[model samples]
Target: MTSLQHVSTISAPLPAPSRQPFALALSILLTAGLTGYLFNAQDSHASLVLLLGAALGITLYHASFGFTTAWRTFITTGRGKAIRAQMLMLAVAVCLFFPALSAGELFGQPVNGFVRPLSVSVLFGAFIFGIGMQIGNGCASGNLYHAGGGQLRAIPSMIGFAAGALWATRDYEWWTTQPSLAPVGLIDMMGVVPAIILNLLVFAAIAGLTRHLEKRRHGELERDDNGSDQPWSRRLLSGPWPFIWGAVALAVLNFATLALIGRPWAVALGYPLWGAKAAEAMNLGLDVDFWGYWLMPGRDTALMGGILEDSASLMNIGVILGALMAATLAGRFSLSWKMPVLQWLAAIIGGLMLGYGATIAFGCNIGAYFGGIASGSLHGWLWLVAAFAGSFVGTWLRPLFGFSRT
Candidate 1:
């Protein structure tokens, strides 16, 4: 080939990733049906929340936005691009969230953030959750999307997650008794503007720190994939999106969630409910109501009512179905049954830790770290510090379970 032709050929867009038409069709059909059901059964708001979750799944899958992977990469290789993306995400989310929370509503709906106590339970739980993220190879949202994207490994992790969350419920009251401060929201303590400024400052500092560390280690910042020369429309439809795009999309969708549902986006809350429902089905001798957690007013109602009645459950379902749609559209939907015994053990144990830790911590990465921080809650910052510490240890342990640190 001539020089010009060679250059043109090299720059040309790569072939499209294969699309799983059947899977795509299935996801589309299910999404449509669910939207109708949620609208009729609950309200327009419920339907909208489900769609927002679908949007979140698509964003997550396309951008490969994952806390576990980002933290692990930073821990193992000092690559800070993904970590910086996380900061961008947080910054955007805080900006969107704080204004609404400060006003105490979004649109006509009264809204609330995920502000909770800073407690020993949170410290210990977030720490273990970080470790779980490394070993399980996925965090709360990660496992859901992975499962949705047809990763067989996530199945075992989810099963263990459910079981572990159930186990935590058995002793939920004990965790509540631990030493803790009352809920402290930056927005609540400081004015909204001040809280936003503080959060923005912290995000910038973290991002800058990562850049410095990455530069020191690699002698330059690592660049993200710039993407091929495909049209933006095609890339949007079947994407390996830029991380910055993912961050922005997530922030917007999360804001949508708040406006629609009067609360931020959260998924881990669904795990224990599914677990309890499953246990009930199997006639597991455990009396769910006997647990103090379930004995709470809303908890009892959720357990007794149909799963569709629960907003979190609906959103979680949407996430999975949405991810499936994204995966199939990207022609990346496939499964593997083969897992080494050691790796399998890691999945189960790690999942258990994730489930248990999230339950005690009152949320996972999405709920605790992302939602908490976006809400300007002190606990969110605590969760971040503790989880990162745990992730550091978990990264070191990955090789023992046959996972590469990178």
Candidate 2:
């Protein structure tokens, strides 16, 4: 890639507004009611965590912290700042998670990390998910926030994602049948302190490497980001937030989720559960409980509950609504009826593939990559490598679908 191609770009900036009072009022009132109801109906703990998820959505939108765009920029532009920021976030998360996980308990509750075996399913699933991210124009979390923010096309992508995830459930038995290596937890093997040290070392090395590559290619580290001279409060409410700030906040939020939920955060697990509920509602009579994939106690129970009762579902809703609120505040929340035929096609296909891939892989970016890595799973490292490779292929296919590359 040339120096010209390495520069970052935002094709469409969010529209400006002095205020979106209606959205501001609506967003707060609706969520407050839901949170109050959930506190009475469910646990106060889960309700609070759901609100945190909304905060995450707001942070994500304001910052425009995107894995898809970041990866695409790196692939096409040789920019490594985003990747470095990811490393920093991961490093902080590692510090926070290790001591908690290594103790094998938090707040008097026993907890464990996701440490799944290395399998063919993970490799292929993450790879396909990578392609889906490019085509769908977002990852699991990305799709949620963008959809909430009234990106009309995100709805189709989300539908496709759920469809694809359910479709992959049919092959759950077959996918796992591929010979696999046993799961390994770095903490379990090397102890908490060693795991933290090793992870930090790896993160530092990667950060250093990206810095070298980017500087060698582009002759500088920081990208041009001229900001508006708006008041602090106004700018805070309406934003194109700093990428590093978003990254740090996400790491902290994920840590909080772990503390509250007793496990690492997961974004895509609810997709299939939502599908099963929909199928049941439609009188399709899907025997999800009998399905071998959800034979476990946790999976089985999540299936039995209504969507609103599920914690992950609540969090997901919060994220979408939060993004909606943020976009509204930014005056960027508007529907678009017109989309290119190929773009629509890409969205559907990409979403479906993402859903399918995430199912097989054990999680999406949040579940497998972020939480998995923070929890010291070997599968997380492999997911990163495989998904990046898939992104390379997906980037090549983008122009064929009429997405312009910078």
Candidate whose lDDT is highest: 1
For each candidate in the order shown, give its overall lDDT on alpha carbons. 0.84, 0.80
Candidate 1 lDDT, tens digit per residue, 69-97? Answer: 77877887898888899899999999899
Q: Pick the candidate with the highest TM-score.
A: 1
Note the residue pairs that clash in candidate 1: 18-331
* TM-score for each candidate, following the candidate numbering: 0.94, 0.93
True-vs-predicted CA distance for residue 55, candidate 2, Å: 1.1
Error of 2 at 188 (Å): 1.2
85-186 per-residue lDDT for model 2 (tens digits) = 889889999999999899988878777788888989999999999988887777888888877776666777888888888888877888888978999899
Q: Where does the lowest 10-residue lDDT sum fall in candidate 2?
A: 1-10
